[model samples]
Target: MQFGDFYYPLPANEPVLQYAPGSKEKAALKAALKQLKSEKIEVPMYIGADEVHTANKSTMHPPHQHKHVLGTYSEGDAGHVKKAINAALKAKDKWANLSWENRANIFLKAADLLATKYRFQMVAATMHGQSKNAYQAEIDSACELIDFLRFNVHFLSEIYRQQPISVAGIQNRVEYRPLEGFVLAVSPFNFTAIGGNLPTSAAMCGNVVVWKPAHTQVYSAQLFMRILKEAGLPNGVINLIYVDGPVLGEECFNHPDFAGVHFTGSTGVFNHMWKTIGENMSKYKSYPRIVGETGGKDFVLIHKSANPDVVVAALLRGAFEYQGQKCSAASRAYLPSNIATEIKKKMVAELKEMKMGSVEDFTNFVNAVIDEKSFDKIERYIKNARKRDSGAKVIAGGKCDKTEGYFIEPTVIETTDPYYVTMCEEIFGPVLTIYVYDENKFDDILKIVDNTSPYALTGAIIAQDRYAVELATNKLRNSAGNFYINDKPTGAVVGQQPFGGARASGTNDKAGSILNLYRWLSARTVKEVLTPVTDYRYPFLQEK
Candidate 1:
């Protein structure tokens, strides 16, 4: 069934699932599974009128829709960049003039539409297109999106209704308004919610946005746009495009009206964009805002006093959920030497109990990685682990199911060697590396965790003592933007947990308790007089 302008639902579960292993029912189910695996899930391609007219290289294939063509021009080429900026500038006036109430209502309605009517289709499409597991797709793409939209309305209300402060013998009143120019949103595919939040947050603040979603997540992005349009967002308020990185980057950074870029991706890309913006600083209409969240080599610390259950639960959720694709997904765990053996045993037993199967299988805990490239990357990491001279041993899950979609078993590595490549990189897969810390060399171990990673997106410390937790939290200060005490590093709630990171993670904190909307807006203060006074003498009036 069609969920929106861009989504279709998967076939339903049949009765053959009830059979025991190797039984007739099981045989039929296996055949059905094989057929499903073999089937090519076709996606629709949307084409821009200009691309169609120009007979450009962007025509949609049978199932793939060529939607999201980059702004109708070349990237970096001054003429085309100006054309795109002009298009956004032209759209900004009307979009900004819209009443805050109108924007809020529309956001609410659209969210409701997504949650109630489009949920299943969106879930299935995200699962198919982004290789998200069913639960992750549904929860993150649909449910979390709904939560974000609903929370956004509240955020807007707070921003708009902020009361003027009346200080003793001083007047302090603040009025917030949109940035006058356009915003450029460059999003990633890890969480489809980022697509909605990044652009929606900008539009919420009355900024016109030209959003470029990751190519891999085009379908999900298109479906989201369809929902936004259906909810009565003005035409051109959000301009969707599908262009490559270098081209679009040059265009966005070099444009005169390019107010800022809200980006979520790798550190290398973020750095490049930042450098581009810096290089073209003099050409811009204003100093552009650059808010981004990039890479993360997040960690989990298990103190000697921690509960085994807590460590196990946190690691399972943080490492394996979403196939460890989230920026905050746990990649390293530092354990005290005393509990290292027990923790490893618990982790191994827990991983064994964790089922791995198709995304649609509710009982399956581990799902396929996003695509073949990611699959191969994980395979390579496992191979690297095997080559480790010491300190690294793959305790579980070092195999790939070649016949199926990009599926790899969740891998756990036990190590004392600090130089293990798996321990150092972001990995971005379901490979959790455990390191044992010497009690006498605790400071040295902390230093290793702190300095080993280049990323500071997220980190967590599991300790029973408040002082130890605080000490560890302070020591690994550069680890992540959002640090956790008892919980896993992932699953940050929208408004309550404003998510984003420092260093390579992001410029603007996307979600959490922070005022992220400010990242999308430039403050505008409007003073309206209750009593009109004609041109009276002022202390600092300009001489005519």
Candidate 2:
């Protein structure tokens, strides 16, 4: 394995499996789901080499089947957060000093295992725990995580190959060392890939990490942790813990060795953490690197030349897939008056036809949202939109039923007001709001689209006319980080579109790129002079 200098070419994105009927993948995943559902296991926090389970346990339930207990995870307090930090620090030196190729191989091996050995199980866990249907689980938990692992290894390799050019009889080198202290990775429940990538990306860069995944994601998060262990990750390199967010933050932010944090969640939480870290800056050994991707009130803009069918499909998939839990989901739309009627008619009809239920039944196009809190939040938004004075009329789907599980009907509201609260604020749910604009005033509408929302995470402009497309593109250039043309704003592939946004959305470090990897690294340049300077004097100092 150490025969020569390592060269890992760009890795391809993992192909998303379509678990169609009678497909082998479908059968395997069904089996995995059955197996997981049949057993109730006790999950523990992984601290150093130990599986730390406490009496304080929180039960895990399928979002689509709240009564069915998947398992229980040991909930920790500030003490466990402290332990995780200590574990990361204890393993820091060895993990950082490990051979670069070996470090790279561990992640490579993990990627392979995820793609092959545990593929079905991983997808199954996501489907059950996150309430994601088959295709949604495949694209997110399987394909995206696999792509992140493989592509990260390749990206880190490229980073290691960068060196300074040497002059005559002098050799120059730069060492991309891991940061002096530990990294804290706080990942959200929406994407299991982020839960895995947040910790592994830092650990892959020779920095040890303490990962605290959202409590709702523990079902799949624990599975990925096991895969990492099996893939030869050294103990304490990445410590996984389940704890109260504030307690964990209090401990980590106050610690002197808190090197950095890789985060993905809401803008409010991200802003709070930034403030906390800033307040405790003097306590840290070095300036802590804060990288985060926060909330998005993403948009979809329609033009007169846009195909009604295309707009309908884009809105259907973009707004309701995974119950519109995605941060990049198209929550708002600006439809041209010329084609808006046709698009709305088609969209409403399609929504009526789509089935909604548990992920167990693959035919269900819409599943339950994450949990009760999210269910209530989405319900509030729908209720507010229904008020007569709100000036927004529900065109289709505004039902919230939680008898069996937290389910919200895929709702669409058409409002005459452009900056209606539902359209401006972040609503992480199965709701889409549309505002009709004069077809000829496309440019003016684009300005409203740009200025309406504070978030600039993701957006799309659907148009067949080149001039209209170009105008919207130029006008809304800063409106979205990942701008799509004639396509839904969500579903950004890893290697193809590195995702993140600025202006309160996040630091825009652009995860899945070398830019994110560089945050975990601290560089040191060394220049060896073959001809040593005899004195600290130059020709000018010597009066030459």
User: Model 2, which residues run further than 4 Å from truth?
Assistant: 1-3, 535-537, 540-544
lDDT digits (tens) for residues 85-105 of candidate 2: 999999999999898889999
Per-residue lDDT tens digits for candidate 1, residues 1-544, read 2232211122121111233455653454345334433444332222211211222323211111112122222122333334545666777877787766677778888888886666666665576556665557766787778777777667666666565756444555566667868888889888888888888888887888877787667757777888887898776677676667887777777677788888888888889888888999898888988888888888998888899889999999999998888999999988888887888888888888988766546577777776667778889888877775755788888887645566788998877677577788888888999888875566677788788887788889888978888888889877778889988988876655678777667664666333777676666554445556586878588676
Model 1 ranges off by over 4 Å = 1-86, 163-175, 388-391, 401-403, 508-514, 526-544
Return the clash pairs for model 2, or none: none
Each prediction's RMSD to truth: 8.3, 1.3
Question: On a 0 to 1 TM-score scale, where does candidate 1 land against the true structure?
Answer: 0.82
lDDT of 1: 0.72
